[model samples]
Target: MVDSLSELMIILNRTYKEGNVFKKVVKQIPEVEAAKIGEISKRISKAKQTVFEATAHLDRQVWQETKTSAQQGRIAAEATRKTAHDIRARVIDLQQETSEGHDKLSSQVDQFRSQMVDAADQMGDQLAQTKRQITKDGEERKQFEAGLQRLVDALPASIHEQLQSALYQFVADAIVQRQLFALPSNIISPNSPPLPLVQYAQVLSESDIINLLQTPDPIGDADRILRKESLMSDEALGYATLLRQKRQFKEWLSSDWPSLVLVDGCSRGESVGRTSPMSFFTASFASTLIRAETGIVLQFFCGHHIDPQKENSGPKGLLRSIISQLILYPKSYNLSLNFVDQGLYDAVAASNTEALCYFFEKLFWQIQPDTIIYVLIDSVSDFESDLHDYGERMDRVLILFQTLIGQVLQGFAAGPKLKLFMTSPNRSHRLIYRVDQAKESIRLNAAALGDISRSGERSLREIRRARSPLSYIM
Candidate 1:
């Protein structure tokens, strides 16, 4: 019973101790709550500061972007103003230039009008003078005819009969000559002859002969066509002058018989001016022949390295150009074109080489007996092109001349006399050989030219002035 009492007292003591522990925990609750509230206030203050800093950073970015945009807008506005000013200035300049051009054009037009008016007045005066001269000529002709009739009537009966017969014969001859001179209008055909002589005449008046031949004009120094400026060099002129003084050359010029003179520049050494100088010599000689007015001068300056239609540098173009020049020759002669028959016209229209040769032969036969025809063909070597069959073609050209010369020799008693003058360079041995075969051909080598290169050189301007048409008349 005493042991149980001791255990109950020990329990009571332990319960008292646990009660003390509870009281102590209860007392620390207020301090713990105070500490937690202080920590929460600090956290709230930090959060407020962070939000303020973020808002301030956003405001600064917005202000900077606005300032940049304002600056760009100001720059763009200035650029636009500058562009507008430049455009206005450009427009003003263009307007001023246009006004000046218009004024200059108007002034030119006024000057042209005045020149045209003066030309018209001069033409009118010339026409009036021509009409008066024609009237005077007609009156004189009438008076002469009346006087002749009175003289015939006053003659004796037997003498009058003879005079009347002679007068009738003269009138008939005049009528026949007139008929010969008339244009070949009667020979025109619808299907065959594409262009009649009359129409061809019109074309000749409007266009150059080179265009009709469908051949490029012979290339020269400054012009395509052979002009005085480009025709001859000083050395060539001296050679030509020297040649003209030669007894043989003068004989050829004055010869009544048909002849072929082949000038071979090839016979001499390389230094003998056998290239362009040879061409110049031939051209100068031809010009001299033309100025002499001895006969109809037909010239063909063969071109080298011609492309596309290389045949034009050969005999085909030569014949065609000759026929063309013949048709236009004696520009003052009032002849009805009786010579150009339908066949010849057709051949010319067709441009058939063989036919042209045939018709040319016939035309040559038809020329007035005793009339001299000079054919000057320069640079015979230039007939050869890059054509595969160039040799054959060149042979054909040589054969054509041979045939013509043969015909002339055969018909020595009849037909018009033809004088063929040809020039060749030094390299063309074959051509020189072929030409040398002609019995009637008179060959003049570079030795005949006689140091013409050593002669004084004349300026091209001087040559042109010297070769002027007025110089020829003088």
Candidate 2:
């Protein structure tokens, strides 16, 4: 029994030892669970640490981006400010340049004004000087014209042509530069007349003469004229002769009779060949007399041609025919009141001086005019030589009126006044000689006759160039 109990106790002891080993295993299992839990915690801690590092990297990148953006914005603002400053500087420079140009223009305007003022003052001075000079010249010219008028009026009728030509030349020299002038190329005269003393042409009026020289139109004449119409027209001497014959002495009253007379040519006929006429008939002479102040005076010119048949054939016909008509005219005067022989002669001879002088004296004694009678003869060369032949004939012919003057002087207590003018042709022609004892008595000596010359050729050339007065003056 004891042996069996000992075995059981030993087995139980072994089993208890195994149970302690199991307990130890169980305690080791709890420690393993704790270790597992610690490992998981370590892994979780690593993940969290990775997340924190990623978050820190993202924060740094964001900070860098924001700083760079701010720097770029500041740089852009600086550029805008610089551009604005440069634009302002250019605007200021342009304004200064414009102001400088305006100042220069203003200076030029002031200079132009100064020059204009000086020019105006100079023009005023010239105007004043010219006015004074014109006044002085006018006075001198007036006095000269008056002297010319008086001198020309005093010239005797006999030398009017030479004198007139000389006068024209003097005027031309003073006024003009040329002498191209139109002259009368044709002059026609007929032989028929009412009396031997041919009166001024009755039908051919002054205007008719002018028209004849102007445009002379012949009725139904298909032929051309001798002279150009314009040459003989109003531009030349168409009516100049009319102007020269203003005074008619025959119509003058006793108080209005002419004291001075002028004549042109003596007689134009064949009668001049035998006896040159030194004296003229009283009635015929009176017809062509003019006084400077009063009375009718005429200028009668007989052309050089005596007759067509004679050497110096005048216009035409004979002087004997012309003189016969005058002698045939009946004498009509009272013998009781008039002098029957004082200045009257019944004889009619062609070449007798005594007959001519008595006839001349008879004509003068009939007229009793108030003014002094003055006779003007153009030339003594035209008188016939055979007319003055004998001594008794020459005495009566030369001083036939001296005895009548003595009788009239005693009866009326004074004598009728008479003056004579005998002009000559050439400087050599003897026109006057001592007719009586009276040396102071008066006679036109041929040597005393003034010789007039034609004007210079150069002077004529200049006058002809003068522009026509009708063209511009009128």
Candidate 3:
């Protein structure tokens, strides 16, 4: 029993010792945990310090960024202020310019309105003046018409009828002629009295004689004749002589009384050729006189053909052409007054030589005083000279012209100034002699013409030499 008790005591003692060891292990575990906790606390403190330092650095960086941001914002605000100021300045300038432009436009509009008003006023004044003038013209026209009616009523019925018919026919012919020649019809006023023949004549200008002649173009004929004769050159002596003669002819034209100029081509001691320089000269001169528009120029170009049917080539043709020209003459006062001359009309229509002579004589008397009449007879030698009674016929023509010339020389105070220009070949010596009795005569010769030509050539050569480059260089 005592042994069992001692083993129990030993077991109890070992249990106690094991309990103390567990307690000490428990205590050591706590110390080890405390040490580890201290190390962890130190590590946590270091980490916290590092975290605070990093936070401070971050705060500093954030503050610097905020300050930089504020500076940039300030700088942006300044730039924006400057930009706003510039915008305001630009807006002010634009408004000022707009105001100036509006003011200028308004001023221009006002000036234009004033000009328009002035123009309207001037236009109204001009219109009023025109109306007044038109009224005055109407009164004068009525008075003139009343006087014309009174004069017409005083005439015998038969005479009035004849006058009316003649006037109507004349007016119709004038209108027809105007249309045919493409002449302006403005002279014939639609409102004017149809029988105002004198007034109409005054309004109408004398036109080209070709309108009446109805012959081949005389100007072209003249040019052709001149070219064919080789007398077209101005430097030629013959042409020069002819020019002198033309000037003399123009001088004769200035004479107050009836004068005759006879150009004898055969005086140059040449045969009675178909064409002569004198013929061309006469034709061209007649054309020039007609163009002068100073007087009545009647021309008869006796073409080479002497067919009686061709009235422009014979004596009958001459009378017909002259009468037609006279009919167209601007001096229509006497013609209109004495237009009832049936004999003259019949003679013209029939183409009778004797009747034409009588008609021409009567018509010649009817020409207004101070009026100039030019009769140009070119190539008179071609007047039926082949016939047996050529001299007799030519003498008759000569007598007719001489009678008219003599009448003019007798100084009928109321007669027109007449000038007769004739070109003839020396084939008819008697005819030439009769013409030579005239106040003016031109006799052309080959020798004199040759001398003049040689002198002209020498002069031309000298002139050329003077103008030459070689002469200038020398």
Clashing pairs in 1: 181-335, 181-336, 182-335, 182-336, 182-337, 183-336
lDDT of 1 by residue, 70-117 (tens): 999999999999999999999999999999999999999999999999
In model 1, which runs have C-alpha deviations exceeding 4 angstroms? 1-167, 170-250, 267-275, 310-312, 331-347, 384-413, 436-474
Report the lDDT tens digits of candidate 3 across residue range 90-179.
999999999999999999999999999999999999999999999999999999999999999998899999998999999998864433
lDDT of each: 0.58, 0.35, 0.60
Candidate number with greatest TM-score: 1
Q: Which candidate do you rate higher for TM-score, 1 or 3?
A: 1
TM-score for candidate 1, residues paired by index: 0.46
lDDT (Cα, 0-100) at 302 in candidate 2: 23
lDDT of 1 at 162: 89
- Indicate which candidate wins on lDDT: 3
Q: 121, model 3: CA deviation in Å?
A: 86
Model 1: lDDT to the true structure: 0.58
Which model is ahead, 1 or 2, in terms of lDDT? 1
